[model samples]
Target: MILLPTINRSVLLVIPKQPFYDWSNKLFPDLEPTNMADIDEYNSYLLEDELFIDDPKGELKSYWKKIFLNELYEQCMDETTFPALSWKLFTQWFDFHRSAVVSDLTSDPLYTDE
Candidate 1:
């Protein structure tokens, strides 16, 4: 069972123990597989800038955005693994940075709309 707090209420999600264990193991291979703390910590890392800074050309950032969207889609398939706030944080950052990148290019005279 996992508890998530929303704006107006708290949600409780229950998962079968065996499947939860398996999913947890796949998500967190280095730690004790069933621990929510480990999952939270892993999610926290996804919010870090370092995760998208490896590629000099910024392709890795776009790649990670797709990966995160895919993860969000998978999580939506099961409430028990749905990490709503974490997904929001990732997408908010991704969208903001992506737009900033576009703006930087468009702001130049060579790429102007007019």
Candidate 2:
């Protein structure tokens, strides 16, 4: 699992181990997801990019754009392999991130009970 720390919270990218190379290519084509240390380094690069500029305002749309690309979706839809499992895992991961964003928004100081 790769832990991606965003502006508001951390996201865990759970890539299946059986097809490690295949999933690695699909999820992280530019870098390798070897361990937490590597993923942490990669996360630094992501945080520095312009896509994360609006992260503090509760806008993390870029993450979804990066994760749910057409090619990745098609790869997950391959019928001869673990299509259902892949789809399920992707959705679960996405749901967790989405929930985290919502939680962050709701718990912000503007809406806090303090």
Candidate 3:
């Protein structure tokens, strides 16, 4: 969908593996289902447990965190890609960082008081 005008200004129209962000409601309301609740639920998709996937500390990189992070930054900052690629990166990073903040939050502690 990235190649589509709906995705960005770039005619090349390339969608990365992960959307990295979701403004479909703001960007395209017409795409929503007819039901309002469905739209609300869909809007909440980003905050749901499954969508918060992250490779904390670069374990996926086989202990090479720096190289993996560099690649992630490049994936996020390729100025040659779209006109707003940098903006996309910024927003994505913000979402990731913000999620990291709340990820540890819990109503109940793992260790309970007797």
Residue 25: error of model 3 in Å?
1.8
Model 2 residue runs over 4 Å out of place are: 1-22, 25-33, 41-66, 70-86, 91-95, 99-114
- Model 2 lowest lDDT segment of ten: 40-49
Candidate 2: C-alpha RMSD after superposition: 13.9
Query: What local distance difference test score does each model get?
Result: 0.37, 0.38, 0.30
For candidate 3, report its TM-score.
0.18
TM-score of predicted model 1? 0.23
Scored by TM-score, the top model is 1
lDDT of 3 by residue, 39-62 (tens): 222111112222223543332233
Ranking by TM-score: 1, 2, 3
Per-residue lDDT over 1-114 for candidate 1, one digit per residue giving the tens place of the 0 to 100 score: 944321221121122233334654666577665644334322211232223333423534444445554545544455456444343444343322321111122332433253
Q: What does candidate 2's lDDT look like per residue over 2-109, in tens digits?
A: 543335444433332334335635555676544422332111112222333335224444444454443245444553443333444544433321223212324334
Clashing pairs in 1: none
Residue 7 in candidate 1, Cα distance off native in Å = 46
Model 3: lDDT of residue 19: 41
TM-score per candidate, chains pooled: 0.23, 0.22, 0.18
Q: In order, how many clashes per candidate?
A: 0, 0, 1
